[model samples]
Target: MQLVTWNTQWCCGLDGVVSPQRIVQHARALADFDVLCLQEIAVHYPALEGNAGHDQVALLRALLPGYQVFFGAAVDEWTPDGQRQRFGNLIATRLPVLQLQHHPLPYPADAGVRSMPRMCTVATVRDPGLGAVRVMTTHLEFYSKRQRMAQARALRVLHAQACAHAVAPPEASGDGSPFQSKAHTPHAVLCGDFNFEPHEPEHAAICAPAGADDSEGAPLGMRLWDSWRLLHAAAPQPPTFRLYDRRYGPEPGSCDFVFVSDSLKGRVQRFVVDAATQASDHQPVAVSIA
Candidate 1:
């Protein structure tokens, strides 16, 4: 399966134009993705640069027909016009979605640092070859180091929780209720704009194992492995941000990445960063697993 993750910056390109259609076009040009994960999608928030309070989730849904779209709003509020405005991550997939979940990451208050609530959207999809696979996408806190670390820890906890569920699934009623059994695989792909460079401790924290106790004889749950490292062990990671847009600072480096559980490490066929697209301030990262 082919999956792509990108932070659209609300679809505003380097030219300062916010167009959802343009974002879709750029993504399609990258690859024929089975799943597309996006972060920083805004809805009814005109304060963003080049954004006019457009419903990005709706626009993307309309653009990609037959794709199941799931939006996890970390910042949800009502607009002056009484419309519900949301800002967060979105996952759209052409594969069959069996289950969906929105997990709000830890957001501890930090004084004098601009930060916002963040979330990860998890979807269990039926891949034609992989069968059941859990895919999750998230955008970590950018300004506050403490908050980002907490959020990273929370992601590890969530992964462990999902594994526990998979190992001991709940009993299902056979009374023909709508609550039927569904596929829940321990194998997961966590991808998104991590907001931390490879040199940062937060990156290592996320990839760290839950604990020795948690993996006592389980062949299912395992620590996440960096997809880039799995494929390019000797090469430096390609820059995924600050390549051309240096408004924040100079020096190009990667903050976006695709990480897979150890179980799926060998299945990782390709990992790439689309450095050519200026569709957003951040570049798109694609991963192919077979």
Candidate 2:
């Protein structure tokens, strides 16, 4: 299975153009991805640089004909004109989707830092190679360290709960109601802009061992393994943020990541980053699992 993740900066490229067409074209050029996970998708936010209040989800759906697009809006608010505005993450895939869940992450009160609500979009899809696996994409709070840490820990808890569910699935039910049984698997691919560096505590919080001190007698949970580290053991991780655009910081840092569960770590065949693309401030990352 081929998966690609990117922070599209609301489809605003470095050239001061907000074009979903270019984002789709460039992503297609990067790889023949079965699933594409994206962050910072905007809807009705004309105030953003170069954005004209376009519904990016609709635009992306029109562009990707065979794929299903799922969006989770972290910031959903009303404008004075009564139109709704949304900004958050999105996932598009050609694979068969079994179930979907949108989780609102913890947004703690940070007195002096500017922050926004955050969320994670989870899609359980049937991959031809990996079968039923969850693909989760999220963008954490960037400006607040306390909020970021809380969000990261919340993500780990969510993963562990899903893993526990997979280990002990509910009883089979085909009543054609909401309780109907769906495809369940522990295998997962979590990717997005974490807004924290590799050495940061938030990163450690995410990749930390699961179920180390479980109060409940649930099965031992599986910890996530960084895909880049699995493939590139010694070399430093390539910068995925602020490589060409130095407005954020003078030094480029690797903030975006794609992590897989321990079960899928051995299946990680390839990991690649498109460092040459100026489609967005952040670079696009792709991974292949066999």
Candidate with the greatest TM-score versus the true structure: 2
**Cα-based lDDT at residue 102, candidate 2:** 97
The C-alpha stretches of model 1 lying farther than 4 A from their native spots are: 175-180, 212-221
Per-candidate local distance difference test:
0.87, 0.91
lDDT score for residue 174 of model 2: 98
Give model 1's TM-score versus the native structure: 0.94
Q: Give the worst 10-residue stretch by lDDT in candidate 2.
A: 212-221
TM-scores for all candidates: the values are 0.94, 0.97
Candidate 1 colliding pairs: none
- The segments of candidate 2 whose C-alpha lies over 4 angstroms from its true place after superposition are 213-218
The RMSD (Cα, Å) of candidate 2 is 1.2
Whole-model alpha-carbon lDDT for candidate 2 = 0.91
